[model samples]
Target: MVDQQWTGVRRRVVALGARADSGQVFGSLGHRWVLEDPLSAAELAELEAQTGARLPEDYRDFLTGVGAGGAGPAYGLFPVRRVQGRWRWEGDGAELADPSMLARPFPGHGPDPESLAALLAERPEEEDFDASEEFDDAVEAWDERWEAVMFAPERTAGAIVISHVGCAQREWLIVSGAHRGTIWSDCRADDTDLAPLVDDDGRPLTFAGWYTTWLEAAELTSRQ
Candidate 1:
């Protein structure tokens, strides 16, 4: 039986790509609507073994039924591959996810709000320093502090970076915690905390919902 979750997804993506103006859509050129071959049962099992966590069901079905990655939201979904006999996802910032820590719980919150505000306020301004060298030193010092508070490895445990939205921004899929199967947006590059990707009803978006939403929009854009 076909998994209803991904029914007709591959076909619809291909159909949209066939449209002459599909490439006109934003980010279409990057993926060119090309999806990699789906993973086989053995490959999927090996991936699960390597990660030490079974992937979210919706995402797992996508890998087995649709494709491992490609032609997805933003620049496209990051593809997972085996190198040196080990499985890992490949893309900008994809390495941020540590597979060894996939089973841990994702942090429920980021740095304390008051402290983060204080840190942001302390961000150095070039005009405040008379010498460029002095300003550079100040900026570097501030950046180190910011990274320590914001980009701590523990912040993203149990999550994997699934896609990049450019500008050093990326999205994550929670794999082994209360938020498993849900997608979260990462905007730490802009000094904002990671948050769940919610739908029109303000509910969290699952992997199936996130991908299908993008696919539907792409189809609509291509036809127009």
Candidate 2:
């Protein structure tokens, strides 16, 4: 249980306006991601052990390669490297950033009364409450993390991603964006295996979009 302090690497979030492919996104927003280093070698090692989950090759390469201690290049909405310290968080050719726009839960998705009732019915333990709170705080810390919601998304994706990442005993899903409706990861496999998404025969994939083929989210706390 070593608490290793990771390098304060920078991940910039720039804003965008239009969808590059469509060439039209006036009232839209996007971002440009950049990963900066000067990180601690020890932190990387500690992260590997703490997560107990190996990062993908592309992700790993992005961290420990030529960009290990400096700004790299940009890749898609998430630039692998950049030339600045602040993340591109504005309207570009892709989209833009708006905290007020995402202050609510989901865009069209409101609070699930049924879900809330179910939660209140079950009095979770102190640890459960603590974990949930932590998850929530982390989600609020980042906007682009909204790729974990299928509901109103852009408004709640960040929260959902936090829940998934901070979950100590449940499966999680990750989408491409707030409303992309894709799959990311299923923490609770048949046993306790934690691998990326796969096909029918077990071939790895770049991404799985969004899906609910995993465990029931609400059930995570009550199960234990």
Tens digit per residue, CA lDDT, model 2, 1-224:
21111222232111111213221221111212222442245545554443333433333443453233212111122222222532122212112222233222223233455753453344334455458787566545422222222123253332122112223322222222342222234232121222344555665333211111111221232233
For model 1, what is the error of residue 216's alpha carbon versus the real structure, in angstroms, after optimal superposition? 0.7
Best by lDDT: 1
The whole-model lDDT of each prediction reads 0.91, 0.29
- The per-residue C-alpha lDDT of model 2 at residue 213 equals 17
TM-score of each: 0.96, 0.24
Worst 10 residues of 2 by lDDT: 209-218
lDDT of 1 by residue, 63-92 (tens): 999999999999899999889999999989
- The TM-score, computed over Cα atoms with residue i paired to residue i, of candidate 2 is 0.24
Name the lDDT value of residue 74 in candidate 2: 15
